[model samples]
Target: MRSSVKALREQGVWSVEFTEAQYDLLVRSMVTFLAIEKERFARVVTVGPRAEELDAIISGAERVHGGKAVIRTSLDDIHMIHSMLVFLPTLFTSEEDFVTRVGFFKENVAEVAAGLKRAIVRTAVDV
Candidate 1:
């Protein structure tokens, strides 16, 4: 799935078809994954920086899960979410790795979750 998305991105194709139901499932799955990551992170690093960033990512995912935020039904968004999910596990190999890679992790989450709140307003106006 990751390679397929990368290929699509390389081809400059940003559109993908996903029913609203599928989008809902995707968001829920993402939230679940992040929640699991939180647990792993806590175990790996009892106290550390970037913890708040993880919390913020979870909050963003929760907002989207609860329909308080809207996700643009774009393939790029799907790719990003998938990429984050895939990348998160790599951080758990060691504490040092997690610390070093967390900034990148948070960046990806923020980028993927960015503007989700604004999407809700735009969608409502369109409707």
Candidate 2:
């Protein structure tokens, strides 16, 4: 996924398939990636359980900003992650813009990453 993000910066599109379990991790990774690379991924699309939570965060942010975040979601765990990378490059130019775009979502990004990481690890162990 990090590679995809890097490549996306050079090119404009990237899409990768992930299992439903990997999709869960992808959501967390994307959130963390967005937070750290906020300048690069200002606009984003997230999917999975975490994505639903992000939708609420974005909705609240939209209310406060008086403008909508350029984010979209499918609520499907795997598809969201796949589509997100494909959609990411179209949203921002640099990581700074990505961070700025995170806005209020920053508060929840850490918590979500931690939870998703645990879930991903546990799932991996079980499988």
Error of 1 at 120 (Å): 27
- Can you give the lDDT of residue 49 in candidate 2? 38
Error of 2 at 93 (Å): 1.0
Clashes per candidate (backbone, < 3 Å) = 0, 14
TM-score between model 1 and native: 0.28
Model 1 lDDT at residue 95? 51
Candidate 1 stretches greater than 4 Å from native = 1-13, 39-127
Q: Runs in model 2 with CA error above 4 Å?
A: 1-90, 104-118, 121-127
Residue by residue across 1-127, what tens digits does model 1's lDDT show? 1111111122333323223333343444455445555675652353233443433433343233333333333343443454554455454666555435443333333333333323333444554
Estimate every model's Cα lDDT from 0 to 1: 0.39, 0.37
RMSD per model, one decimal: 12.8, 14.5
lDDT agreement of model 1 with the native: 0.39
Best candidate, TM-score: 1
Name the 10 consecutive residues with the lowest summed lDDT in model 2.
1-10
